[model samples]
Target: MHRTYSMRQSRAPTASQIENPPPPPSSTKGGRLFGRSNFGHAFRKGTAGAFGPDLAKKLSQLVKMEKNVMRSMELVGRERMEVAQQLSLWGEGCDEDVSDVTDKLGVLIYEIGELEDQFVDRYDQYRVTIKSIRNIEASVQPSRDRKQKITDQIAQLKYKEPNSPRIVVLEQELVRAEAESLVAEAQLSNITREKLKAAFTYQFDALREHCEKTAIIAGYGKHLLELVDDTPVTPGESRPAYDGYEASKAIIQDCEDALTNWVSGHAQVSSKLSTRARTLSQRRKNNASKRGEGVDLAGQDQPMKGDRDSWVAATEHGEIYQHGQDEDEEEEEEEAEGEHEETNGESGGGLSLMQRIGLQSKE
Candidate 1:
């Protein structure tokens, strides 16, 4: 009968043959191999056998679509990796650009800070200057007003009639007012000049002394100290006064007091010098009087005309006469006396009446 052999009776496989079986013949229907010991073949056959031909064809198409989708995913992953690398490079460039910008910003901030400091310093200086200007204006305002008033008074007086009875009195009043105004203006000018000089001198002396001390302390030598020390040294003299800054009113009274004292001291010195000169001139006159005392004007006995002439000649010549009997001396004295008298007459004749009156008044 058509009975198949049993598995044990078919053939006994060798040990190597059992371990490694021969490849099975391929099947054309399902594109699979049969009688294969491989698990891949069984898996495919199971899948194909479980479904019909139409279903298997649809599954195969689905698997092919999955493979295409996986390939596309791989391509997308590669493009993402390239894009990430480009982004990393751009980030590095951006970091460098940010660093440069940060440095520039820091420098700009520093410049702005310095400019702010300068602006503050300049503003303080401007404020001080404006204050000083205000103080100066205040100081001169009263004087300017007085001068304007005096000028108006003088102008009004000038319009009066030339020969009016009140004209002379008005003219005198105007002159006095003008003189007072001039004195006031001069005093103001002197005050301003002196105050300025004092302020400048005070500041200069302080700075110079400071420089001198610094130079000495730093061992810059005595020469540098001397060069920097420009303070004027006056022996046996009072120190000059300083009114302080013009903007300050506190020291103005002290300044005025000092100026008055200084003026008084100057006047005292001038008076002393003038007195000394006058004393010297008086002493000279006294010596001349002593020299003239030797001349005998009131004599009890009258001398002969010839002897009198000789004696007068000797006196006019400013010669001390030794009572000697020499003829040459007497003759020379007589000639000199005649010449002196003639010269005196010529000079006296030339004097005007006013000069003669002045001379008589002095006598």
Candidate 2:
């Protein structure tokens, strides 16, 4: 059996943004990774563990590999934004419905890319936490080496000068080194378990958020697709003019509202864990409880890792206005637009609301 969407990310700020306004540091979210390439990443990985102490070498490699993962993710996010802009550009010359829908689709896809990039920052938190584990491993290595060195000297003194006066002193040093090594090893064991759990817990929680929001966009994307009329017409017959402008705009507003209101407790999807999996998870929790242990990193009350408003709709006034028209008013507006389309026998005039407002989908 597989784990369901049981993981929840609950870190977004609950405070209203239009009132508080995001701080200036958020400008760094769209910062690009300059001069990065596969070759450079490979070189970094190759050298990571090569010169490190033997005990920490493998963990050093792991740390570098995680950096590689973040780099790849950043690249994907950047490329997706480019693709979204290209999609919008291509659709600009099409008919009104296709043009409007594709433009909105571009907005959604670009938001996806922005979400991905934002996710990279959250993922870094996990990577940095793992680095703590690597540091502990590296620190433990010195004690291990000191203990081994003392042991080797003891063996050499025994062989070279049996019953030498220095042998007893060396033996005493070995005892002290062994005790130090024991403390270091114990610290390493406890830290490794604690940090490993915290790191992956952070990763999976962020992942849940990323995946759920993308799914939300996908659902709205399907709605946008429905607005496009795909009816087949006779070669000589003229098709009716498109009138989905109001509908498409309303859908965008709805999407923005949905995303803004989303929280972990209200996640749309959930999985049904297998009996075995549930049992195993329960056992793990029970064992941790028996240890009388505590965790510091995973549950700390922290500000959001990324901006929640980054992916939502924006306006030209340096403010986001939420439209709250009733269904009757929406239906009336649609009917009026339909009449206008039929009377004109073409699309409406001038730039639409989208162009006027200028959605700042990216930074």
Candidate 3:
């Protein structure tokens, strides 16, 4: 009655139709060729009987095992990377320690060599002063002998003729001879034999002290070399089998001990040498001043200002009496600077390459 063409509802869909519906229409050529629904239906149809429930369950277990193996492999790879990074850092630290030890040993060797050089220089100065004193004595000996002969002749003449013109002329000649002798004596006095002797003694002592110190330093250096040489080289490796850090530390301690002993033993000797050197220098200055007075007297007669200026410059230079204090100060300053740099390097921690890379990636 409702136009009641509920036209008997079309017969219910058949079982096959209900289970496998027709594909939907597509708008494009590619879509028609391989539509999403068609692909899913085809896949399901193709695989429908390929595996039974039991086979699928076994396949799932195999897949899970494979995934677990992959995860384990990834975990092992990460551990290996961490170990490699640790080894790299340790190797770098060992290299840095070796370099530091080597540099310090080299500096010690250089210092020992410098001390030897100073000893030689001081020895040479001592020898020169000794020779100068000998030359002064030799020159004065002839003047003394001539003066003695003149005195003898005058005494003989006085005995022969008390008022003779020859006697008078001989007396005048004796006066001139005496004046020459006095001048020679004065020149000899200016050389200051006692001061030269003192200088020589100090230099000899200093040379001995330096020799002992050098022996100590050289022994320490040789020990260090031996230790370094004893390090074992492994096949296919550029570095030694052993890092030698502990050995280096022991050697450093030994060196410090040796240095302490040397300083203690030589401190007084050094002070004595310094004091003797200063005294000798003062004596030389006084002698030079007196010689300058004589030079002034000579200038009154010869008007030679150039010679006087040269003598003054020579005294002022005092090359013969110069000490190694300046050099020692420079060496101490250099050591201080090196220590400061080492401290700074130690205090300033650095990041590894991987860590830096990670930070950069994060940024």
Candidate 4:
């Protein structure tokens, strides 16, 4: 028996190990949790009939929790995308605001320079007035000295005991001339003082206007900075109504501003057209009253929006009848037809000896 006996068989697992399992189902892949095996089939058979009491409820809860977690992650991803988009819009608005501010600042600088030029001109005028006033004041003494010399000459003549009426009249004329000169000197001094005062006042006014304009420019710059810093982010909602509202608002503002500028430019053009029309109408009435002359005058009065000469033939002269123009046009057409017929005959028929002689003479 000891020489050739087979090894004894091992003992099988107990019924307790097969029935109530020590460990739960595995949570890893490639691990048998439910299948046809000694322990696995027993576990499946035990859990098969218990659907809603304990284990199934736990599995349902776990599935629901997994779905909720996946949904939360999706929401987080969408929120990140929305935030990125809003940031991009905010950055774009900031850039556009900065560009607009830069253009406006350039215009403001040009305006300020123009104002400075005006101020300098006014200051120069004021200085000229001051010089004129000093010069007039200096001349007052010379006029007084001339008057005293005239008085002394008159006294000397009277001391000569000249009872002539001619001498007395001459002295009286000299005295009147001296008195007029003094009066003229006083008037000139007053005029010079007024001119100097007015020039200084104008310079001061120009300076104040320039300062106000500069302050306005500065305020615009500050507003530009604020717009850049406070640029708001647009939401990701597909609100066509909101977008349309903003677009319409922008369009309305643009139209209003355009209308203002157009009115200003139109006013200037109207004034110029009025003056030109008055001058040209008088000239046209003085000149020929032909249809072409009236058309030219009307063209000058009512110029086109951009091209001024397009409607030059629309006006009729006061004295030139439409029938006359039609008759003249018909006569010109008849003459053209006769010339064309003569050319056709000359081309079709052989040239005459006179025509050949004339042609040779021309050549």
Give the root-mean-square deviation of each candidate in angstroms. 64.9, 18.1, 43.1, 49.5
Span of 10 residues, lowest total lDDT, candidate 4: 1-10
Per-candidate local distance difference test: 0.32, 0.62, 0.42, 0.37
Winning candidate number (lDDT): 2
lDDT of 1 at 97: 30
In model 4, the runs with Cα more than 4 Å from the true position are 1-103, 122-142, 148-178, 230-363
lDDT of 2: 0.62
Q: Which segments of candidate 2 are over 4 A away from where they belong?
A: 1-34, 280-363
lDDT of 4 by residue, 91-200 (tens): 43434444333333333333333334333444444433443333333334344555667777777777785675656776776777677565645455455567667757
- How close to the true structure is residue 195 of candidate 2, measured as C-alpha lDDT? 80
Candidate 1 lDDT tens digits, 1-363: 110110111223323224434222111111112211244333443442132222123333333233233223333433433443343333334333332222222222222222222222222322223222222223333434555566665566567544556656656766765654454444444444644465454334323332332232233222222322235668886434432222111122232233223221122212245888999999999999888765333342223234211212333222112222122234335534444433231110111112211221121
lDDT value for candidate 1?
A: 0.32
The positional error of residue 339 in candidate 3, measured at the CA in angstroms, is 34
- Writing each residue's lDDT as its tens digit, candidate 3 over 103-203 gives 33643543443344334444444433443343334334445666778788878877887666786777787788778677656555554456467656856
- Candidate 3, TM-score vs. the true structure? 0.34
Error of 3 at 167 (Å): 3.4
lDDT of 4 at 253: 37
Clashing pairs in 1: none
Give candidate 4's whole-model lDDT.
0.37
Comparing candidate 2 with candidate 3, which one achieves the higher TM-score? 2
Backbone clash total for model 3 is 0
TM-score of every candidate: 0.21, 0.72, 0.34, 0.28
